[model samples]
Target: MELQLGVLGVGHLSTAILQGVFEHGVLDPGSVLLADRDPDRLEDFAGLGCPVVPSTELVRAPRILCAVRPQDFPAAAAELAPLGSEHLVISVMAGLGSDSIRSSLGGACRVVRTMPNAGAVLGCSMTAVARGPGATDDDDAFVERLFGAIGLTVEIDERMLSAATAVSGSGPGWVYLLASAMHDAAVAVGFDSQLADTKVRQTILAAARTLETSGQPFDQLIEGIASKGGTTEAGLRVMRENGFVEAVVAGITAARDRGDALGAADQ
Candidate 1:
């Protein structure tokens, strides 16, 4: 909680991240070093008991977190080169890897490449991480802690970052896709829109909470709600017969491939 942290952007993820850091006891607000090009927005860091500096000044902190957009990567990473080998570069930019970041920072800063979804704002995100070859176990552990400050953390080979992107990173989009379909289907079935919205929302949330808290087997729990010869069972039968899971899996595969294409382009 006492370690130095420099947050290098003032965007949504950065702001939500800053808030999560405060709410989840990741670091004392006073210990955070913040920077952004927009001085007006950077002032938000003030109430958190932080020091707001010009972007270049943030390079002084040993644990530098780059939450800027992919387009800003080069300039931002360049500014931190002076910090050199001492700083661990943890980045949240998609389509850019640790090697590119380390390369931009003069090849000595240890890099941690991570992908976190928008749910990070809600403290329920799943973060995927991979380390630069030079990174030590302690560096990886620190990267884990940094993301754990918000939600779940999983480490994998850097090669799988695209798979991680296709899943958790772009997962919220997939979840939203299903939710939207469900919502529209409910309204199509002669239900009031508001009623349909509330039912879908509560049902999804209830089922998720049950999954998290219940010690029962998922099939048993699901079967309990979907009895023999009931509406839910009939719907489940239709979904299974129509290959609902197969379609979802296909979408994820496509997403993963696209991410791979993007990475390959950078080479």
Candidate 2:
């Protein structure tokens, strides 16, 4: 069978996307081609029946998923300079815009940029997709289907991608930081380390599920748990006093700024 998807760069995020789609039966190995600078990575995927082709051969597939690092795109782009409007370039690289991607690939291909969070490993990522110049509605739908295999996807303007990067893309890292602190706090309060870990993890899982399924707003949900002058309120008061919300907003803004800088550097 002819190859349907050509995957460039088999790094952690790309690997997770591939695994999610493969395991969910959204795509099969026979129709997917893999390429990476790392021989070991290519060899690993090759064992799963995906042919490891050079970047130059990626043109054989109409749809190419480019997951190379932001710093590595120039070289990868050079190798795919032969691509034209017939190709659909789906890029998941952080900080790189669709315009930049198209220009780097000789400005003759359709591009779709996406930001998928680390939860992709668990097939629960929140992915943001932005259509680039020359991409059609069909292209966007195709992209949504691909990323949707790994997680929920939202379509936003290309200009808002930097903000999306800070939120959905880096949001998991922020949650991880909060989870670590909660685990530490539990340990400090006399819980054993193993038990603390278990408690923190399960709490996060349940809380996330509730946040997704509950129709109530965040404040309402918090109010449901934290009665007036209760233990939960007491703890929340301390967090508020410590400027937790402000700190999180500031951190996300800083991350967005960094993403902008990375995009500027590429341009």
Candidate 3:
């Protein structure tokens, strides 16, 4: 609560984070300043009693959270260029590296980059934090604390952040895709749409809980459910024959590669 935070954008990810922090009592609404190009987006925070400030005045807070889209960073950077050495800037913009952010923000502001998924809305995000040049231990701990309010936090080398972006940041979408496929398949096979949706949702939740508590490798878990010549085996065999696992690996790799490409382009 002692930290006076300034948030420069209120897009989906930022909105989730702010909602989590406020819901969990991690920070008081009154201590945070919010800003966004779209006034409608700021209305939620404003309703929560968080002060809305102009982007140019974000530097007034010692710790600034930059959640702007990567394409919009240049203009946001111009407004934040006045940040001094004492300021710490936490960025959630995908594919924008710390070096690029620091240079654009007057070359003195401390930068910490993080990737948190939309799960933060319910305080279950798996956030990855990477400390940047000139960021102190205190700064790193502060970043961890802020993200910990939403869920678990992992500190990783900045070089691996792109991989983290693919695995955790975009991981939810992949799961949803699989769930949707299963739901539609159930409906196609004669279950009512509502029943298929409910069953699929429960199945996913149960499987996730089992995976967390099983203490076994994924292959072993899969093998347990798939007996020889059984129904599970039949479905799994078709998936294997159709390159399901390979497709998943390739998809994640492509996402990581795209993130790298975006960062390179920014540089």
Candidate 4:
């Protein structure tokens, strides 16, 4: 059977996306085709019952998900060039823009660029999508629904994709760093490693759930926890004095600048 969805790469992010699609029943497993240079990666997907095909066969699918790293995209695009305007191309590669994909794959295809975090593996990612000139509202909706199966989806201007890449694409690593710090702090206070890990993980999960469900602003949430002269206030004050916020801002700015440089290279 001709595939409906084609995945060009089978790396971590692509695997997460494919897992979500399978878990959500978004597409029949038999109708999805996967391609990767790594034999182990191909075997992994083959075990899940997805056909491991060549890039030539995969790109024949009506909708293609380009999940290769930015450096690997040119070769994938060359393989996909025979596809025409009917194909809807969605790329999850950071630093690769839609114009470059269109140019590399022949200008006839519709392209949508997206950034999905590692949370996609757990169906909780915050995915940001942007459309190219050839895309239509239907194309936008299709991309949104495709990513939404794996997590929350938002539409943003293509110009802001680099900013989104910094925040959403790179944001998970930042959160993990903070989690590591919290775990270390807990251990310093005499908790065992297992206990500290459990507590820190639960705390972060609870905070994220509260933020999602509560209608309160982030500052209000923080204020609620940090009573005047309380322990939370003391800790927060120490963080502020140590330029924690400034450091975070600087990190995000660096990621965004790097993304800009990559985009420039593509252009």
Best by lDDT: 3
Per-model TM-score versus the true fold: 0.92, 0.91, 0.89, 0.89
Error of 4 at 228 (Å): 2.0
lDDT of 1 at 73: 80
lDDT of 2 at 130: 91
TM-score of 2: 0.91
Off by over 4 Å in 1: 1-3, 215-218
Q: What is the lDDT of candidate 3?
A: 0.90
What are the per-residue Cα lDDT tens digits for candidate 1 across 1-267? 464788888788888777877777867878888888887777767876788887788776778889999888878877767567778888888888777777787877878888888788888878998887477888888777667877888988889999999998999788778778899999999888899888888888887789778999988997998989999999999999999989989999999999888877765
Model 4, backbone clash pairs (residues 3+ apart or across chains), number: 0
The candidate with the higher lDDT, 1 or 2, is 2
Best-fitting candidate, scored by TM-score: 1
Clashes of each: 0, 0, 0, 0
For all candidates in order, the CA lDDT equals 0.83, 0.89, 0.90, 0.87
For candidate 2, give the lDDT of residue 118.
Answer: 82
Q: Between candidates 1 and 3, which one is better according to lDDT?
A: 3
Candidate 2 C-alpha lDDT tens digits along 29-106: 888988888888777568878988888898899899999888798999899896889999999988887888899888
Relative to the true structure, candidate 3 reaches a TM of 0.89
Inter-residue clash pairs, candidate 1: none
